[model samples]
Target: MQEPIRQSYEAAKELYAQHGIDVDQVLRELEKLKISVHCWQGDDVRGFLFQDQALTGGISVTGNYPGAARTPNELRSDLEKAFSLIPGKHKVNLHAIYADTEEKPELDELEPRHFQRWVDWARERGLGLDFNPTCFSHEMSKDGLTLSHPDPAVRRFWIDHCKASRRIGAYFGEQLGQTCVTNVWVPDGYKDTPADRMAPRKRLKASLDEVFAEKLDPSHHLDAVESKLFGLGSEAYTVGSHEFYMGYAIQNHKMICLDAGHFHPTEVISNKLSSLALYTSGILLHVSRPMRWDSDHVVVMDDELLDIGRELVRSRLLDTTHIGLDFFDASINRVAAWVIGTRNTIKALLRAMLEPVEALKKAELDGDFTTRLALTEEFKSYPFGAVWDYYCDKSGVPVRENWLAEVKTYEQNVLLKRGSRASIVN
Candidate 1:
């Protein structure tokens, strides 16, 4: 609505027009894209299930940042604040551990009522909800094993937990009238070398089969399995390795989640999308940044992220790919982290949408590698920022870096007050 922004957007529109790219069309498409924001980031994976317990299952949040949400209401409020600053309609991804209840219900006993509050909250905002079974940070996962544990009792407990979670996911989807993707990710592995790797994987496959024995309607719920190369404790052998999950997903006709930080340091998920899409029904992307490990750092508009957005658009897999953010940075303002990551993700997708894909593909098909490379390089300097700002303006979100001011004000007035309350209670 600002005069300068409108003028800049007009100039950028003209520039893109020269390249046969419609900035308006790109903006329209970008508006339709939705990225599910992870709830764990707001609380650093510290769910309300056990207030005194430390983070378990080879996961840890580094910073002792203040204003971490301690209750369902607080977390939802914080999420609303973050969503207000980011453009576009988005969804919220919840872990089973985040059940809004006063009594500590056993994993196997968890039902749809535990999440009724979440459903009500999301419905009020016209937002969809995704879910994950909390396979970590509990006594069941103390040994870094759950579904693949050698003990039948331990494995059965986790299976029941997963099954219960699926039912909850179905409830979410049925109430919201949108399919909820309930992903399974267990920290089942060995700290050192294992005498028998195949045995654990076999056990895992059997466990999954039992958990997914009863199929829910696809319209209400979708199942996805996540794999990690290694983790803090399971460095030597991760039972649910990428190869294992890929094979299992393909054989069972399930969605495979490809996390950006769940692979070798040099490997990227963007290149894997095309190949995997050919076999799988769809993909669930856990977009995150890795600092030499699965650190789950806040995302930025980096090259890898841009490549991911480009691949999703270029391959025409946007409809098949379920995009969601997966990161938890306790070092900075949590609301700002959400706003920055979600906005940057939208920005990357918008930039990819603005590309002249038809021209580049034509050059490639005509065997004009030189022309293709030239066109690709030239797009790097396009006025994508202006279009992004225009889109933000239209969405009623802060344009450029203006959102940072709102976050700082919120930290001073709202977040700091929580610290004061804790001190008073102590």
Candidate 2:
């Protein structure tokens, strides 16, 4: 460690000790916390399954950033670089469209063998894997409805795809010895006000029931359903609204995914955690930065992000919560986007873990709001940076913005060379 960093950590450790916060324990807990990084960010959600498919389902990657990964190996290589720059081991979240098979299998025909390379890659790094069934950006979803489409043939295709995805998720868990969260987030909604919304929702619920009919081992595979308020085209009505999924998750005993960008601009997932934790079995958080709409900008260390971490730590919901990042900015260096967002997420959680939660809770319980407020504000200026730097140093990652230099070097040497190979959209 650098001498200055070592000295700063020593001083910060002593300062946190005065507030009854064990810095060592905080770091240890942080070390164990894993943030699942989404593979879509590396290639702007353009998975390897389809070559000519434009991003449908209200999903669009802005900017024609050079060197976006075109193949499975390139994406994995980029992910490796991003993982190296971030602290701690984490899981890799994959979509069904990211299958790495030589055979051109239909979505419904997809099997675990198609994603064997991903499992092998994850196993080699001792990282867990999470999965999603890609229900958008396909020929079947041209009308912007999936799973809830009125046509049974269309609905059956998506249902089978989701079932196949769950099996792949179970295979990941069984092979890696970690529970794989197979989350379902479909873009089944209408652009205009529907004459009948209830029918679509009912169809969706029934479709989901059939999709999850074959129960997988809970120890290996866990199911989660995601909800959205609105999307680019589906601004009028979204079938899987929060209320709908919240009720469904409670009834079906499944995890409900809360994407930060998938709600009203005024609503924050941090506030929903405590209330939902009371009824839901588990939560899958897709942390993102939404600028007014569902424009998935890269996550930053903003107030909402900090509060999300605070809620998880404060409410003791860390164990039941599965945190995954969901943002794709093709405008920036894709690998750097991953590093920046994942590191900030860790920082947010670390900041919360470093808090004197017990004392704060006691003050709240005793009606000492002033003390609680004062301490909360005061800790913001505390030596959190020192401890964070130390943690990064110990984890063998660059501290602060220093990681940017490595990303720049990678761009010059590795990323730029792949520009010709990258599939740039517009």
Candidate 3:
């Protein structure tokens, strides 16, 4: 297998050289690109903070495959397993609800000490950390509103939570020596058509102002606001619509999060990157696969994913873009979901890096429409798989579907044993 992969990669290197493309340089650049893997996938979005409550905030995780991580130790162990299969040293995105604490502290009272274990874990593995404030799944958010809640008391609660979250995020960066991205997303909207929409938007704006009143050093932490078109219960109106956050991000000079699953079914985030980059200081991408609505399915190496990679690479916007996965699937092995999604995202980036971007841009600039289109179509057939296989081998991971067998073996030895014990106890 090693000999065949080496031969294939050598042939691919020569083929790319014909078009003035450097496969070796592309692989090297890919090694530098990191995707922040979400921790929610390991536990089906069930954080340890509130184990008894049902998932809320207009989002739901479907299917119940056994072996969901029940504690912080288990979740971290699962993440380690998933990362070993993936090729790059990536970051871990965490939610406030995942804190390893014995007391059920209110969201506003959360402190950095609660997450010291996670920081130590990341430091030990040389991984970066990203964070999110959990604004859902609590009694305060049962009304499908948070920052935009009409009651001043309820709104203030969420505001305090977000404020504390920023401090915690900055702590992660200060300790790890990597800037942490703390994204704020609220599920505030109406289930049915509301008589007035401006009120909610107004309230949301003021709430955000209060939450961000404290300034944190940009070197340590960055703040981002995420928007959604609609959600499970808030179908009629979503307070944090794309337009609302875009305008806020521009005025506030903050990073705006573009969630792939939060847009209309026909809309893809690939075409929006260049436009947003012109106005915002940076962008945070919540890379997820949307099935008609904001389903948050596991990502695949599909057209839209490839387009996102191409646009990021061609426009040279990678430096300003923070890539993170956002999906939860419990029907299969949760660890496998993380491995598959992260690997596919990496594959898309590798393909984008291998493109003859300079040549294509010259054709466009020269007004050679026919040549540009021809080259665009021709490059699609490039031996991207060979390069991908070689990358896996070099990274010390299995070279293809071979990784699947390892996951199955892990399930039989680890996951299955857990499931069996749970069944017996029940």
Candidate 4:
């Protein structure tokens, strides 16, 4: 540590101790902290080592084949790989039960089929399956807004998605003896300026209002209302910040689903996001660095990395169950993104949570951005050049092609296992 940082550490230590914080205990949680990733369909389960006890396997649409028609054997084998590779106790984000299967004409009573598969998958694993609505799709949301959309067709599609999902979620809860964790991440905003901002936001409010007032089935579901900003690549809108509630989603529609990466282009901090939804008492956070506009560089070279992370975790503003990894890999090796991003998030969370809570208290009480900057500088006295060099170094990942083979074997076992030895739970 540099001379200045060593002094800050001393001060931070004393302040933290004053608040009855135990550094060692907090550090242990950090070490055990595993990140959450989804199980995409094309992924190889054996490529990554997932020994960490706290990591979660997110069942994301991008990761899993939610839209495909699979035999029970195929589904079971795919899930078995997920179970074998990912830590069992971790969570899975259900993007939805039935993906965009409208194009497939051979299907009938679609809801029952997917629900049956989902229930079977859940029963064998004894795992909790969480659902996140596939919002902002081209079909159901031509103009967007589950609650606020002017078009009746768009709004009705959302209702069907919710109603069908709730029924399935309830079934899973009863069959698996686990509640469905539902998150509404449906996109409902504009690409350009609208005549009224609240107009679009109000739609979210209405749907949330419906969830809050009716259509809640505990046997099948638990609610966490998720929202996010429109990408700049898309068109711009006034209520598009994703941080501001607009109207319906928070007060009327559903509970809060806060994703920190959702705020990067806006440059909002973690504390601000937590504060907004902290009152809802239903904050489900999606944690990740959004590397947009070159601002969300997820390196630890500066306080921008730890500044907000420390603030949020230290304040206990977030429940551990509410956090998940939301990182994106512009690179080829996806697992590396989960590893490095989780490592950074865990490290920051520990330093902030385990250290003296008052470490930043003095800086804030001092009430000067410059002083806070200096203190952060002292805390992070690592050589700048070294940090940059390390980030620039692309870690190598060995490529594999056996994921399809494994999927095929799993398909035969789960769907067509006449002579195969694969067990349902195995």
User: Among these predicted structures, which one has the highest TM-score?
Assistant: 2
Best model per lDDT: 2
Instruction: Flag regions of model 4 displaced more than 4 Å.
Output: 1-24, 27-36, 40-89, 97-127, 143-147, 169-180, 196-199, 211-220, 232-234, 238-250, 264-266, 293-305, 358-426
* Pairs that collide, model 2: none
As a whole number from 0 to 100, the lDDT of residue 66 in candidate 2 is: 82
Off by over 4 Å in 2: 420-426
Ranking by TM-score: 2, 1, 3, 4
Q: For candidate 2, write residues 265-381 as lDDT tens digits.
A: 999999999999999889999999999898889999999999999999999999999999999998999999999999999999999998999999999999999999999999999
1 against 2, candidate with superior TM-score: 2
TM-score of 2: 0.98
lDDT of 2: 0.93
Clashing pairs in 1: none
Q: Which stretches in model 3 have alpha-carbon errors above 4 Å?
A: 419-426
Candidate 3 C-alpha lDDT tens digits along 1-426: 499999999999999999898899888888988899999999888787777778888888998788888788888989999999999899999999999877778899999999999999999998999999999999999489999999999999999999999999999999998899999999999999999999999999999999999999899999999999999899999999999999999999999999999999999999999999999889999999999789899999999999999999999998999999999998989999999999999999888888889989999999998988998899899899999999999999988899999999988887776753234324
**Is candidate 1 or 2 superior in lDDT?**
2
Tens-place lDDT digits, model 4, residues 259-287: 66555475745656456554555555566
